[model samples]
Target chain A: DQQVKQNSPSLSVQEGRISILNCDYTNSMFDYFLWYKKYPAEGPTFLISISSIKDKNEDGRFTVFLNKSAKHLSLHIVPSQPGDSAVYFCAASGTNAGNMLTFGGGTRLMVKP
Target chain B: GAGVSQSPSNKVTEKGKDVELRCDPISGHTALYWYRQSLGQGLEFLIYFQGNSAPDKSGLPSDRFSAERTGGSVSTLTIQRTQQEDSAVYLCASSLDVGTAVYEQYFGPGTRLTVT
Candidate 1:
C-alpha cells in the first residue's frame, strides 16, 4: 500500500508566480516529512522538511506546510523560476520507521519562463 | 568533500545471472540506506544500516537479495538470479546520526540495473 501519495502527477506555473504541490499520507505514525527535487539522471536532492511538532518550515524561496490532523502537506515555491523545474518527491518517516523514508510517486514541476 | 558515490552507474545483465552494486557513503556518516525505483513507481526501501547495529532487511523482496556494509563505510547490494522484473534504478543514501535527532540523508546518483 502507498502510505504517501502525491495525487498530482505534474504541475505547471509561469515564472514569478507561485507553485504549489500537494501530498497526503495515510499513516499516523509518520511524524517527519521531507521534500526532494530530482533531475533526469540525478538523485533526489533534499529541499525542505517539517516535523510533526511544527506546522511549517521554510528555506529561501521554498516553504513546506504540514497538517498533522489531516495527514497532508504542501510545498510552496514563490516567484518560481525555470531552474525549479524538476520532479519533486514527498517523503515521510517516523521514529518507528528507523531512519528509512517512504516516498511518493513524485510530481513533475514545470516552471515556465 | 565528496558526497555519496555509487559504482557501475549502469549495469546490464542477462536473466538468471547475479549482479552486485556498490555504494560508498560520505565519510563519518553512520547511517546507510538502499532504495530502488522501478519503472513508473516510487522509491521502495530495501534495507538500512546504522553503526554496527543489526541491519534492517525487512524491505528485501526475497531471500535472493542481500546486502553487506563493511567497515561501516561501503555497502554492497547483491541480487541473485536476476529477472526482468528486477530491473530498476538502485539508489543509496547516507546520513549522520550521531547525537542528532533529525538527520538529513544525502543521495548518490543511482545505478540503473537492467536485466534482459
Candidate 2:
C-alpha cells in the first residue's frame, strides 16, 4: 500500500517550454510536500517544498501547486532547459508519523533540444 | 564541511553472503536514517535513529536487516544471508530531527549492492 504515488514514469518536454509533473497521495495526514531532483549516480537533492496551508509556492521558474481537497500536486517548470533533465521525485511528510518523508516512485524528465 | 559520505560506492557479492554499508553524516546532526532503492522502486525506509531513544525500526523489511549508529554520528547497515532480492542501491541520510515537520533531508551517494 503506497501512500504517495507518481502516476507518470517519464515525461518529455522541449527546451524553453513548460514541463509539468504530477503526483498524488492517499494519506490525508500528509501536510508537507516536497520535490527532489536526482541525477544518475547521485543522491536525490531537495528542490522545492510547500506546506498544506498554502495552495501554491513558487521559486524562480519552478512552481508547486497543491490541491488538498483532491490530494494532488503538480510541479511546473517554465523555460525548461537541458540541465533540467533528470529524475524528479515527490515526497510527503506528516506530523503524526516521525516527520519521516515518504517518497513516490519518480518521474524521469527529459528536456529535448 | 562534508554533506554525507558512504564507503564502497559499489559492491558485488554472491548470494547467502553478508555485507555492511557505512554512512557518515554531518557534524552535530543527531538524526540518521537508512533507505533502500531497488530498480524501478521508490526509496523505502529501513530504519531511523535519534539521540538515545528507541529507534523506529518499523520500516525494516525483515530481521535480516539491522543497523547501528555509534555516538549518533556514523551508522552501519548489515544484511545477513543476502538474497538476490536484496540487490539494490542503499542510501543514507541525516536530518536535524524527525516529527518536526521539517522537509530538509540531506542524502549521500548511495551504495549500489549487486547480489548474484
Pick the TM-score winner.
Answer: 1
Best by DockQ: 2
TM-score of chain A considered alone, across all candidate predictions = 0.98, 0.98
Poorly placed runs, candidate 2 (over 4 Å): none
**Candidate 2 structure quality by residue, lDDT tens digits, A29-109:** 889999999999998898999999999999999999999999999999998999999999999987775677899999999
Local distance difference test, candidate 2? 0.91
TM-score of each: 0.98, 0.97
Model 2 per-residue lDDT tens digits across residues B1-116: 88988978999999999999999998877788899899998889889888788899999998999999988789999999999999999999888874464747889999999999
Model 1 over residues B1-116: C-alpha lDDT tens digits?
A: 99999999999999999999999999999999999999888899999999999999999999999999999999999999999999999999999876436588899999999999
Residue A38 in candidate 2, Cα distance off native in Å: 0.5
lDDT of 1 by residue, A7-109 (tens): 9999999999999999999999888899999999999999999999999999999999999889999999998999999999999988766679999999999
Extract clashing residue pairs from model 1: none
Q: Give the root-mean-square deviation of each candidate in angstroms.
A: 1.0, 1.1
Off by over 4 Å in 1: none
